[model samples]
Target: MKEDSVLKKLSRDWRVVLMVALVIFSVIAIGPHFDENGQFATNLQYGLDLQEGSWLQMEFQAEVVTVQTGQPLQEIAANLSEQLDAEVLPVGPDQIEVRMPMTEAELRPLFEQAGAEVVAVNQGVSKETAESVKRVLDEKVNSLGTKDARVNVLTGLNGITRYVRVELAGVDMETANEIVGKQGKFEIRVETTGDQTQHVLFGDSITSVSTPEKDPHYGKWGVSFTIDEAGAKAFQEAAISSNAVNDPQNHELIMYLDNETVYSAPLTVELANSLKANPVRSLTATTGTGDEGLEKAMNLEIHLRAGSLPVDVKVVGSGSVSAALGDYFKILSFLAAVLALIVVGVVIYYRYREPSIVLPMVMTTLAEILILLGIARFIQQLDLASIAGIIAVMGTGIDQLVVITDEVLHEGRVPSPSVYLKRLGRALGIIMVAASTTIIAMLPLALMDLSTLRGFAIITILGVFVGVLITRPAYGKIIMAILSK
Candidate 1:
């Protein structure tokens, strides 16, 4: 009857119900399942260290400098570009981005020649250019059909992006380099004689490239792009010179990216007649109908943009992990986490020596882990460092539970209902203070772009938050119910 009464009181408690609901929700989010080969898998994503992959850290070859110039910024930028033989553009008020690496000494003279005084020279690209580079890399990686990829821009404390890192899963260092090292160079040429072709224009002439679209009438897939006036005139001149305006079928226009042909199609009769009359600015490269056409059109869109970054880059660091080694690390990480939980449970049992108290503490701690993993599955990828953080959270969680147990059982005796409530509140106050301090300490690491350590810090901070917010209060309510019986 006492046990039944305890169960009834616990069932009525809202805290325990909330904890249970969260556990169930977490399990669903994790979505653990077995693959066809009878191997376990889940929606949880693992980092490069926990899976087969390669990583490349690349430094942008660019600089941002403040200048004082009486000449128009545009003129100075163009003159500086011509003098340095590099891409230079105005970024902000009195600031310009030179898309090449150079020391302050080398830049000062050039700025002076361009009628500008160099105030400061920073060895990194501006934030906007960095983001543009990231977008281009993202498109290139996606076009290659890589399974999982991560591109992170590492900015210094001075708010300049010096390096960008790319992580590709299920690939080697060579393959990773091939993907990120070469920037696409797009060219368009028109077929002349038997196999000879005449150059129409380079990718620089392209003004805009749009997303793939389907033709409503014919169900054909195509990518539309607009070219500059010079490009249009060049295209018209090429068509007239190659006799393509009269014999459209014989004179196929070919597109190449990185010296490899990507698209070839003859101009339609209407387009040929339009080119005969005047230069055409907008054009569509049509692929065949269906899914394959849509896929081709998508790739064509990326190719048309040339996948060119605003600034050049140099690979500074790279590494790779084989599938076998990754599997070994994954197993070790699992074992480490299990060992931590077991050791914590044993210590808790020794301290309390009572099945009721020990069981609730262990169960509560496990629940905390579940909620943490569930939340992490959505926001962060699991890695060896993050697994270490999980173990650390386990130890800290047990300590907080012990504090609660000792506080409520003051003078080695179970407290009355009124006394228990007061003690629980005080215990909660202590836990909150400790949680705040832990969060404060981990905030910098969690927020910074410190690569792997960021994961560890984030998991630690998240674990602390889950414990204080959800599991601890529930454990307090649950322990009170059992002790009252």
Candidate 2:
């Protein structure tokens, strides 16, 4: 009869049903399993701080400058590029990006010579260039097959990105640095008569690579690139010698990055005819049609650049954590979480002096944490800062549960169901306000790339939502039933 009563109560309460469903789903998401070595494990990922890894923070050696000029924007950019021997790009109506490091003093003279005056200079790249740099870094890191790697661009409020942070797990500091620092060697080759390829030009011969774009007329995706005069001449000679101009169908152009063929396609009839006439400085490599074409075009652009960032970067900070130290930190973080829960339980017991009340509060708080971790298993990696956020969540969870308990137990007796519902609504109002405040405060940290604190802020925000939306209401329902009895 008692078991039936408990089942009936759970069935009657939607809050209980939702909470139980979430708990079961969370447990499955966590996926606790034994390894081949018969050791307990979980699907929860750990960040660099919790695993053997190295991290590097690199600053771009470039600057974004606001300029006032009477000259044409393209003319000013061209003159500046010539004078500084670096890539100069116009970012906005009055903003120009210099792709090499130069001080105000060094750039002031060049601006005057180019018929432009420097309004202000900031040590960073434009947002677009920063994204390109980030993409290049991602491709380079991923090419190494490093399973766990992250690249984050740190942008400022003014839309300038000054720094990029990279973290690689299970990699030593030396290897990590090498992987990031090394540049791929790219080459262009022409297919010979019988399954043979002859090299035309190296990556250094390429001067510029444009972003992938779709041809409006044909809707085919392709990347445009510009080669130096010598490279163009060499390419023409290779095509003519290979008889690709006369028999374009049998001959194909192959692009290689680090000796790996990244793209291979036959020359168009127009391109072959043009090559037969003269060297072409500008060339486009068509991938294909549709989304797959666009994807391939983007990859080809990366290959054409040979893993070179649009702006140079200098390592400003770097560090490593040994496997043993990471393991120790992981153990410490686990102990801290366990200790926090125990302390919360003890304090709740001291306040209520009832095992029934204290146990439910502590258990509900633990359930909130479990759900948070389970969700994080898919979207986040546990680190020292995130663990601290988990502890903070525990603290906040207990405080909110106490509010619910005290509100329901007002006048030292359970009220009627109608009054109980009203009090629960009021308690939830308080928790909503508190949760909103916390979410607001952490919003900036979560959105901004402030190193490790980003993880801290994100985990804290997730925990608050889980507590306010899921666990707290369920706790209210559970405690109401116990107090009513």
TM-scores, all candidates, are: 0.78, 0.91
Tens digits of per-residue lDDT for model 2, 319-350: 99999998999999999999999999998999
Global lDDT of model 1 = 0.89
lDDT of 1 by residue, 302-344 (tens): 6887986667788889899999999999999988888888888
Per-candidate Cα lDDT values, in order, are 0.89, 0.90
- Tell me model 2's lDDT, rounded to 2 decimals: 0.90
Q: After superposition on all CA atoms, how large is the RMSD of candidate 1?
A: 7.5
Best lDDT among the predictions, by candidate number? 2
Report how far residue 328 has shifted in candidate 1, in Å. 1.1
